[model samples]
Target: MAPHLGDWRGRYRGAAIAVVRPASTAEVAAVVRACAEAGVPMVPQGGNTSLCGAATPGPDALSVVISLSRLKRVRAIDAANNTITAEAGCVLQTLQEAAAQAGRLFPLSLAAEGSCQIGGNLSTNAGGVQVLRYGNARELTLGLEVVLASGEVWDGLRGLRKDNTGYDLKHLFIGAEGTLGIITAAVLKLFPLPRATATAWLAIASPAVAVRLLGDLQASFGSLLTACELISDLALGLVRKHLPGSSPTLSPSSWHLLIEVSGGDDAQAGQQALEAFLAEALENGTVNDAVLAQSNEQARRLWALRENIGEAQKIEGLSIKHDVSVPISRIAEFVERADRQLAQAFPDIRIVTFGHIGDGNLHYNQSKAEAGDNAAFIAAQSAVNRIVHDLVHQLGGSISAEHGIGQLKREELLRYKSPVEIEMMRAIKRTFDPQGLMNPGKLL
Candidate 1:
């Protein structure tokens, strides 16, 4: 019960009357039915790896937490159809392994893939580094099995890519953050595993340059380009300081781009092509320095630097984190303006920016120097959020990108969302959970 009560980031601590582990979809339905009969609120939790407190119950509510960790099973794999049916509690890495064992690829990946369950990934519509090629959790999903707020099982888990049969009800629950219903099982799309891959880390002048390099890579490689991540000097510095020896030292630059290209069935061909592109970019002065991974082990080491940014930040200290997204064309402008404004408001502010720049999502975070009191720096989260989120909104972007509107950003959701949009979301909530028992005080 205690382990299931808190979020991964240590930002949210909650209380629940009892935590019940349901072994199957039927057991989940029974748990919901029993809770519904007593009119008790319920929180459907998976992995408990939510950074935004999405899985944590409210502190005051005596709700029943329905843990889906027990429902871990890979139901079936249709290699011919390129789909895998898995239970909600199936760990994301496990699903990826299962897909690989079936001679397929499940590309929905993130840093928390080792522990985070597929249920939470679907609920949050998670976007990872591979979103540039594979798309997010929502895009990869074909069907879902949900236990509605009324304790009724809705088995819509069909592995059909072309189901134009009435409304696409599966989408209503995906990215809904479990406010509508509990996802029990899902049929996810898969792809042919890439035999050859090319990864490189490039030191660029700034975000503008990174964006430009992204364009050039897209023009040259097209669908072969799988991931393009942008990282700031400060963000890398933290990783180097806290997690020493984890990443190789590279040329010092204001910004860095970690890009990968995968295709074909031959490794040398892919590497040669990427190497040629990098050499040309270097000669043209677009790239300051570049390191193309010589082998698969080296590529994994390079990716570790990008994936460990969040953990490194935690070790550094408390920071105000903002997961925002803008159009790919406007990323440079958003960063330039936001950095200036935040620096002016809080002097000597250490802003750490990094994320999937290919998809326009940036994890912009801020903390103070070693001499400064981080407690005081964290106290200014509201002012920091205002400067960052307002610019994101002004640039026609989203306040909450991959991280959903959990307890952390409920107010920001209202602040940025239009009245009409808010009303529509509320209407959907009312329609799905009329009794308001499904994960209350969440996205709505």
Candidate 2:
């Protein structure tokens, strides 16, 4: 119960009347019905790996938490249709392994895939390294099975490529963060397993250079360019400092790029294509220095540097973290201006920046240089957020990019979104959950 009441970051702790684990969709429906009849608020939880505290119940209200861990199952796999029907509690890694076994690919990947649930992925519309080629969770999902506010189960699990239906209702629940309903199951899209993959670590001059290189890679490889991640030198240094051996062995530069190209033909062809591109870029000074992985183990090592940024930061100490996204064209400007402004506002603040640059998302985080001053720096998070989020808003960006607006960004959403937009969201919230008993104090 205690574990279920807290979030992954430990930033939020909540109180729940009881945490109930329902083994099946019918059991989940029964729990919902009971909660509804008793006029008790309900919080639907999965994996509990949400960075934004979306799944945790409010400390003020003694609500009933419905943990979906017991509902883990791989319902079916339609290889011909390129879809997988999985229960809510199924771990993301399990689905990926299941897909691999069937000669298919489930590409919704993140650092937390080992522990995060598919239902939570759908709820947050998670974006990961592969999003450059495979889009986010919302685009990958075809259908969902949800338990309505009244305990009625809505099994809209249809695996169709194209449907000219009036309204795509599944989307309403996808990124709603359980404010609308509980996602009991989902029908997710799959791709053909790639025969070969090429991973590389590049030393870049700046974010602008990384963005330009990204355009070049996309033009050359097209859809084969699977991932493009940008990491500041400071960020990579943290990984090297805290998580030794995971950092890539490459010439250090101000900025680094981790790129992967996969699919089409055999391993030799993929490797050749990527090598050719890198050689040309290196000759032209587009890439300062680069290291192309020769084996699968090497590729995984390169990815570990990018994946371990968050954990490394955690190991370092408490920091102000912001998951933001601007247009591909404005990302460089956003980073530059925000960095300068934040530096001026808070002296001695160590900024560790990195993220999926291919999709315009950047995890811009800040902390004090000295561990003793971190507590004081964290107390000024609001000022730091204002500097970062204001720039994001001015550049026509999102403050909460891949991570959905849970309790953490609920207020920020209102500040950035228009009145009409906020009103419309509230209207939908009222429609799906009139009593505001469904994951209250989240999203809208």
Candidate 3:
């Protein structure tokens, strides 16, 4: 077994026959081929930052972990084509900086960008803060180079904007979560870097008000409104308690919105536009108290408050987490209904809600107020999930938003997905991995 497998959360531990670090695509293929011949299952892992436990394998499972960290490299950059081809193990932040150095922007800015690898991002089809302007990892990817379960490398690394070729094979592996193939390298689309930026922190009366304000801001700023995140009072409290130097932005409120607008090099003009929009929003009762960031450092501090939510929650205690998404218009109703039902069932529960509201996704997590009884609260996860997921399904929302269905949500996927859809996914799995030796017992 592998001597050491770094567990990101220390929640799941796995042992493998061996950990193989392949320096190149050919070496990765050879390792897979050898495993295939030996009838051994294989788990392809990158930065090992998966929150869904997708990268963690069971101790009893006979498998080999293929670590792609050694394959880190920036293969090619095409400024004319506005694309960069990078190997699987390239850190997301490094790729972003590389794009910036080339006078372009790769706008997949996640909280874990510093440690997460591009391969894991593509495998999970990660969504980040900028998803409101730029789409998820799938949308940013123009092409991919994957090593299949059968040791076959499919090189569809074309940097074309419009490729109407027979079948778009790249899409199959982007969000496959390592079930179909191992993403070795990819060609990702890049955009012109924004020169000017404006950010605001607004206090809202409720989630409904936040949703209405979002619509107003979108109508006014249009494409310039890059991000609009919603945070609840409970969520902010955790940050204030756990995160150092974190203070409330405005009067304590039920909800807060972190809005940002960016475009060409005219910081003054951007700030004026944002100020004008916020002024009108306040007058129209769309927002209550708002603070516009005067400088980049202030803007970053405000963002730190939003980004440190998960970390703070982890420090607090064990909690039940739900990463869900619904239609933008239905977000207000979803939050209201979910909170009402959960409160009714578990009256003593303390709910902390926040996330990318512009993208209609929320991290609706709950923890016991008294830390000593966390075990009892965690033991009710299945029931809590049912209550939340059922409401999400009723609202035409997804049970899992950015976090893919790993072993954590496999049964939930079956419960939520249509039989026909599940059957089709199974068929695809059989087609690509007939022996089910690639990341077996995951995402099915």
What's the CA error at residue 150 for candidate 1, in Å? 0.6
| TM agreement with the true structure for every prediction | 0.99, 0.99, 0.98
Error of 1 at 380 (Å): 1.7
Clashing pairs in 3: none
- Show how many residue pairs clash in every candidate, following the order shown: 0, 0, 0
lDDT of 3 by residue, 1-444 (tens): 343354565567878888889999999999999988889999899888887778877677588899999889999989999999999999999999999999999999888899899999999999989999999999999999999998989998999989896999999998888999999999999999899999999999998888888888888889988999999988988998998884545876789999999996899999998999889887987788899999999899899989889889989888888899999889989888888999898878899999999999899998888867777888989999999999999989998889887778999999999999999999999999999999987899
CA lDDT of each prediction against the hidden true structure: 0.93, 0.92, 0.89
Candidate 1 RMSD computed on C-alpha atoms after optimal superposition onto the true structure: 1.0
Candidate 1 lDDT at 64 equals 91
Q: Compose the digit string of candidate 1's lDDT tens values, residues 123-241.
A: 99999999999899899999999999999999999999898889999999999999999999999999999999999999999999999999999999999999999999888888888
Worst 10 residues of 2 by lDDT: 243-252
Model 2, 259-319: lDDT tens per residue? 9999986999899989999999999999999999999999999999899998898888888
